[model samples]
Target: MKKTITIPLGSQHISLLEPVRFNFSCENEKITDVDYNVGFVHRGIEKACTEKFEYKQVGYVVARVCGLCAITHTMAYTLGIEHILNIKTNKKIDYLRILMLELDRIHSHLLCLAHTAENSGFEGMFMKIMGDRELVMDIQEAISGNRVQFDFVCIGGVNRDISTECEKLAFTNLALLDKKVDDLIGKFTSNWSTALKYKNIGALSYDDAFNFNALGPLARAAGAAIDVRAESSILPYKEVGYKMILGQNGDIYDRNLVRLKEIKNSILMCQNILSGLTEGEILVKFKGKPNGESFTRLEAPRGEIFYYLNANGTNMLQRVRIKTPTFSQIPGMVEIFKGSDYADAPAILASFDPCMSCTAK
Candidate 1:
């Protein structure tokens, strides 16, 4: 019998962007069993949201759950509160919210692609993708007045409207970013390191994905048709040309391809949103505290993010619960680690784009 040894990937590792730990039981170089820990970075954000912050203030507070998807968190929390309050947002508000969300998706996906490239020893490609990601960040800053943590969403609607200059900046930068993404699609497909080597590494089967309850691109990459954007009507996703991009294999290559294709789709949706901007107020005035319980689901860059709120007709909430995609996909991620070479763990982990902060919160 081959000797079995255990190795730990992270709680703090060079290959990890988050504080997640993975223990791999390996026989020779093949991973035979896998265990993970995602609670290292927990900050008690949920506790604070329900106990300290009021209903209106919770939107900005929840935005701190994850820097990459700050807008997603805020939007989900805002929508949940709005649902309890019976607030009806107009067309322009919906469009603006979607615009910020797609832009957030573009930047987040590019960051994941960059991380995957770096973890796979392609530092040059990583740098290039990061540079291209700045275009999207610039557009977001122009619109939201912040780069990473955009507290742009509120209870009823958005905090700001797209101005003429911001619109011009969006059109110009998005046109350039679209061309760069096309080039990236070509490189990701043809490059030996990003494409061939990653083809069958760390693959998750469709059945495994379904059985494990995978969400977002992780599930879609495994041939599982799961996406909150397509399933939920919380936003006007269908009106803004939202398409669910899927891949046959759940390997690193397929995950990278799924993200690249989604970035292209998000860019198109952003353009469509800008071109079809409706005339209305971004933020609508409202009163009365939310008394009932409400929940919302949104498709974040990594996966589906869920928010549940229970209010007691007061300023503070009784309970605030968040079910992030990475939290749900941990089992699916561990399932993929088995039967793979130990050397590929970094690349595989990066492809999942696990957000520990969001999960822990």
Candidate 2:
């Protein structure tokens, strides 16, 4: 008889950045079953948004859901509120929003790639990716006055406008990032060692992805062709040449490739935004309190993040619900782990880029 042992990863582990605990039941060296705990980082932000903060302040409040995709969180919430208020923002505001969104995507995808490389025992690639990621961070800071939690997006429009100096800085840094990302694409695609560790490992098929309702990179990697940016009209994603990147294998390597290609595409979108930016107001005024239900969706770094809001014509909102990508991908995550080697678990998890804070919130 084969004896099975259970291994626990995280709740506090080197591979994980947030509080996510995974219990893997292993038969010999293969994972047979898996369980995960995501409530360890729950902060009750949903309740707090409606109870503690007013409607206008909820944008900044939801931005705390996750530091990496804070812009997406705020933008989704603001869009929901704007929907409730029926505010039509100007083209300049929309362009600025897309610029920041793509910047966030670029940095977030780089971080995921770096983490995947580090987990796969490629420390040098990890360092190189990390170093290149700062170019995007620098542009983000130059535009938003902060690196992580910019709070740039708000109801009606954005809080800050891009200046000529900021535009110059953005273009310069993006050029550097574009070159580095191209190099990364070559390395990830051509490196044999990367393939050995990543190819055919932790693969999720299209059927499995659809059955599990996988979102974001995981779904795209499986050739699911589901992206909120492409589906939703909330933003001008079509106008900015947003193309969905897909993969055939849906393994760790495919996930990395999808992210790399996404970084390249995001860079193109940012360049387009900067080159043809129109002159208009960043923020528009909307009167009266929110009094209806509304929802909005946006493609975050990991996947699609959704926001639902209910208002009662008062200072405080009635309800705020957030359905994050990581949370939705949990089932798909567990499914992928069932047949993989225990040793490859960390690399697989890192590829999914699970954000427990967003899940537990």
Candidate 3:
């Protein structure tokens, strides 16, 4: 006969960056059951978007949902409002938007990888990756004048245009970051601890991923053919040389590799956007209050971020709803926790890159 005990891992654990709680049922060293909770950091941003802020101001408010994914939140909200108003932006707006988006993805993925390394006891690698991540952060600051919570995207367009000097800086820094990413690929793939120790740890099968509706790198790491970039025409992703990346084993190692490849692909897309630059207005002036409901989806670094907006012929929106990737993938995450080693919980959690703030918002 075997005995089981329950252990709690969050809501304020050192391993977590935000407030999320997990209770594990364990027998000896192995986990037998799991319970997850994520509302500790909830700030009522969705309610504020409808009642406290006007439609135009909601973009800025929602941008605070997650600092790592501010641009995506603003973009998704803006696109939803634009859809309701039936406004079609020009090529230059689309190109510049894609540039910021890919840059956001680059930094977000690097941060996740660095945390994963740190969780696995590779402090040196964590520091190296964090240091290199500054390259993309600098580019974003040079373009938008902020490192985090850029407030770059607006209801009709972006806040500013890329200057010649800024574009030159982006090119130079991205080239350097490209080389750094190649080196990271080598380290994550060939290093003994990062590569071997991660093998077969916290794995999710392809069928399980599909059944649970896993999104972003989690699903892609399990070889599930699900990606908003490949499925939707909401943005000009296909025009900017975007390609879907997939992994075979669905383990921690596979998830890390998938992010590395995505970083590489995002670099390519940013370069393409800059190379095929167009000339036009970044913002379009429109005079009308929103009157209908609209839904929009954008691929954030973690996965597909969705927005729903409803307006009743006024400046104040009737309702605002957000469905984040982390919220959707909770089922898949709980599934991965079962039968995993209790000692591996932190590393496995880090590998999933759960963004509790975004989920709770």
Best by lDDT: 3
lDDT of 1 by residue, 188-231 (tens): 89999888889998899999999999988888999899999999
- The whole-model C-alpha lDDT of candidate 3 against the native structure comes to 0.93
The alpha-carbon lDDT assigned to residue 53 of candidate 1 equals 80
Task: State residue 357's C-alpha deviation in candidate 2, in Å.
Answer: 0.9
Residues 96-131, candidate 3: write the lDDT tens digits: 999999999999999999999998888999999999
| Cα TM-score of candidate 2 | 0.98
Which segments of model 1 are wrong by more than 4 Å? Answer: none
TM-scores, each model vs. reference: 0.98, 0.98, 0.99
- Of the two candidates 2 and 3, the one with more favorable lDDT, higher being better, is 3
If ranked by lDDT, best first, what sequence of candidates would result?
3, 1, 2
The pairs that clash in candidate 1 are none
How many clashes does the backbone of model 3 have?
0
**Displacement of the residue 211 alpha carbon in candidate 3, Å:** 0.7
Selected candidate, larger lDDT, 1 vs 3: 3
Show how many residue pairs clash in every candidate, following the order shown.
0, 1, 0
